[model samples]
Target: MIAQLARKIRYIADPAFDTRDGYGGKLVIALRDGTFIERTEPYHWGSPELPISAHDIYDKFEANTAASHLVGNVGKIISMIAALEDVGRVGDIVELCRREQD
Candidate 1:
């Protein structure tokens, strides 16, 4: 339920701005068979939902009209997650998720 709501929120918020790729740029996905695949590129980032919470409470709607804005630094966030993965650091990942909740 939360994921569905978040996807609707994201689509309504930014129809043009897709989710991030694993490494850097936003992910462009193929929706089929109730599954999505990342259409990768040379500078691909991770799939969108992978980096964010199952629910995106980001105030995208309110921020849309602002002249200047700051996007959540997802690449850095993913890097931290990757570092945790590389070191077999599950506890750190949990802590990171907790911080994100705050």
Candidate 2:
């Protein structure tokens, strides 16, 4: 699977991206219609100026864990984390994340 995927992937360097202050990048998706979807990102994100919303954070978590055995605990974990100051023990969160024994 990896070998087949590697053959179709191409890596290239573009002089446009600069890293004086931080890493910069441009993402372009080439479509068959001779058009490209492009986005210019000046640098890495998640700073105070580029804060990630709580909704986006939960969406990412849900997308990654949708197929895992721990799917049942996602809701509870998010709730506990949101009100972390009221949580008596961090162990409660850890227990919900325990891996199923193979």
Candidate 3:
């Protein structure tokens, strides 16, 4: 299965793309049907031009942290992070992130 899937996929790097600061340029997808699809994004998503919303951040956090070390503490983490200005001790948040005993 791995070999068959590897044969269907190929990654070709383009030296012309300005990928110095994690910027994504043109992406071309050539399917087996002799058709190609292209997408170009010169700037990163969280950059000035393509700013992300707080909701987007929350969603992404939830997605990435699924079944993580802080499984049941995600809501508390989000709440504390949202009101970070009033959080006097950063260790409180750090404590929540720590995995409990087995």
Which one is best on TM-score?
3
Candidate order, lDDT descending = 3, 2, 1
Q: Report the C-alpha lDDT of model 1 over 8-42, residue by residue, as the tens digit.
A: 53322333334342343344454556776654333
Worst 10 residues of 1 by lDDT: 53-62
Checking candidate 3 for backbone clashes, the offending pairs are: none
Number of the predicted model whose lDDT against the real structure is largest: 3
> Cα lDDT for residue 71, model 3?
66
**Residue ranges of candidate 3 with Cα displaced over 4 Å:** 1-7, 20-22
Q: Candidate 1 vs candidate 2: which has greater lDDT?
A: 2
Candidate 3 local lDDT, 14-102, one digit each (tens) = 77666775576777788789999999887788987789998899888888889698768888898999999999899999999888887
Residue lDDT tens for model 2, 1-91: 9999678667666677665644667777777898989897776665454677888888888889999977999999889888999999999
lDDT accuracy of residue 70 in candidate 3: 76
Where does candidate 2 have its weakest 10-residue lDDT segment? 16-25
Which is the better candidate, 1 or 3, if ranked by lDDT? Answer: 3
Model 2 steric clash pairs = none
lDDT of 3 at 39: 91
